[model samples]
Target: MTRYDFLPRLVALPGVYRPQADTRLLAAALTQEPLRSGAKVVEIGTGTGALALQAAARGADVTAIDVAWPAVLAARLNGWRHRLPVRVRHGDFEARTQGLRFDLALANPPYVPSPDARLPTRGARRAWDAGTDGRAVLDRICEAAPSLLRPGGVLLMVHSGMCGVEKTLELLGREGMSGQVTERALVPWGPVLRSRRAWLRNQGLAGDSHEQEELVIVRAQKS
Candidate 1:
């Protein structure tokens, strides 16, 4: 029932994407959703189930998915420890969400721009390595959102401005949803971003002395 105090109750296994600034921003946006009982929610790319727990605490029926088994375990354990009704699953989101229709969907997927066009197939890198332009996963989510959402359902996703906020809005628009950045925060570069700082600068995603990246939460709702 505590906010931003999940670390102690959460089961932090290796390779799991720990709750970070992006998680907090997306969770903050989630709190604005209608989370009354009977509301169905699906969270793609759930890490430790932070957002899922938040939604469940508000009375929404929350189901969360993560590709990593350890992450799934962690998420489930966190929900159990907190006595929240969050269903955590380990599998590819595309497969897990099949035939699923929800009143709300949430995601804080990997949007870090990497040097390679191919995304990581396994390991810790899978949590942050998006393609060179960083839209590999985001594009897929945009394509799948419409199908996953029920009428009047909404999707809230967070990503770095480096991935092009306008582009995300455009993709969601194409999905027949009205979308926009609803929340933004300037976050100092994390370890991963710091490690890729030089390449990011070369790609013009980062400026000289610009150690911060703007994170945005895009909210899309089906009319």
Candidate 2:
């Protein structure tokens, strides 16, 4: 069962990314993590702060960030409404580290492989469009995980398997972090994926008229 097996309803402001398969997949994996009491946690690309709220509910102090301003506002509102004490910040999650580290790091970043060569600078597209290979942000996170996590801290991140799970595991290993797929789920294509069905098929990221996509939750522990 997913931590969001009973995903609490949240007010999704216009233009904010709504929680979906990737979110629930990670949430399920989160329930398996060793979340100690009062453990300090951070979530990049928090979106509506749903996952951050989940971490908080586990009795962990949560800090979350989103690059989209509207998402930032929505997350803040949700945190306030739920009284989760999630510090929702609007900025680049990677650049705003400021030397702070966390016991656990979580993310469900934009991993939809798109035709566009560059990640969108604005709009809702920024929430899901990773460059052509869908590793733009994922690669950045893998590189930044070492800096964001304290020794032995764990990073739990979710993304489409279409983006290459092996690469993530390999990258984390290179950083001295042993990682594995703690959870995997095959979810049907949502509106976003459905709309880009043809493009995805052309890129071989999807099967012919593929109706489902695989999602994976990678759990990496920094040593």
Candidate 3:
């Protein structure tokens, strides 16, 4: 069964996308890394607390922040269920984490771009919706990541292949961060791709015959 399937009923509500393979890959990277036990870790978009819980279980001191109330609550509930000591809070990554530096930082922001790109609930919209290019939220995270991370800290993020991996790398480079692709897989894009085809076609692309969306895992370090 999927992690979403195993999640608590309350966490299975709308607007909460479950952790996918990218999440698992990121968790594994953190495990393999040299983060000491009780090292400070921050999770920017703690959807369902899957990654945060995993980090906390590995003995990292974790603080998970999400703008969505339900997501924060769900994360807390999930942490409680798993007996993990994760602090779930309702806040944005850039605004809420001022003066906080962590040994490890991770985020799986809403990298999907859509015209009707509003969250299912008002509370959840802020957690999703990355503006027209789908890079708005991710860009903000990249810009603020350096400040949020301690020296020699790491940042792990996942975004779409359609979101321009090269551009993301450029942004990271500009921020004095270096990253490498850790994992990539083609997965479905749900319903947004149906409407996005016209936009692609306008840019001289064809129909929506592609069934898979690219999932890219990037691990970066602050230099």
User: RMSD to native for every prediction?
Assistant: 1.3, 1.7, 3.3
TM-score of each: 0.96, 0.95, 0.86
Q: Estimate candidate 1's alpha-carbon lDDT, on a 0 to 1 scale.
A: 0.88
Give per-residue CA lDDT, model 1, range 163-183, as digits (tens): 999999999999899998899
Candidate 2: tens digits of C-alpha lDDT, residues 1-223: 2465336677778888888778877887888788998898999998898889889888898899999989989888887877778888789987777779999999999999998888899898999999999999999999889889999999999999999999999998898888998888888788888888889889888888689889988999988
lDDT of 3 by residue, 1-223 (tens): 2333333333534676666655666666655667678999999888888878777877889999987877887888888777789988887677878888999998888876655544434644555566666787888888887899888999988888767788888888899999888888776656556657777555433344766777888888997
Alpha-carbon deviation at 221 in model 3, angstroms: 0.5
Worst 10 residues of 1 by lDDT: 1-10
Stretches > 4 Å off in candidate 2: none
Give the winner by TM-score: 1 or 3.
1
lDDT of 3 at 105: 92
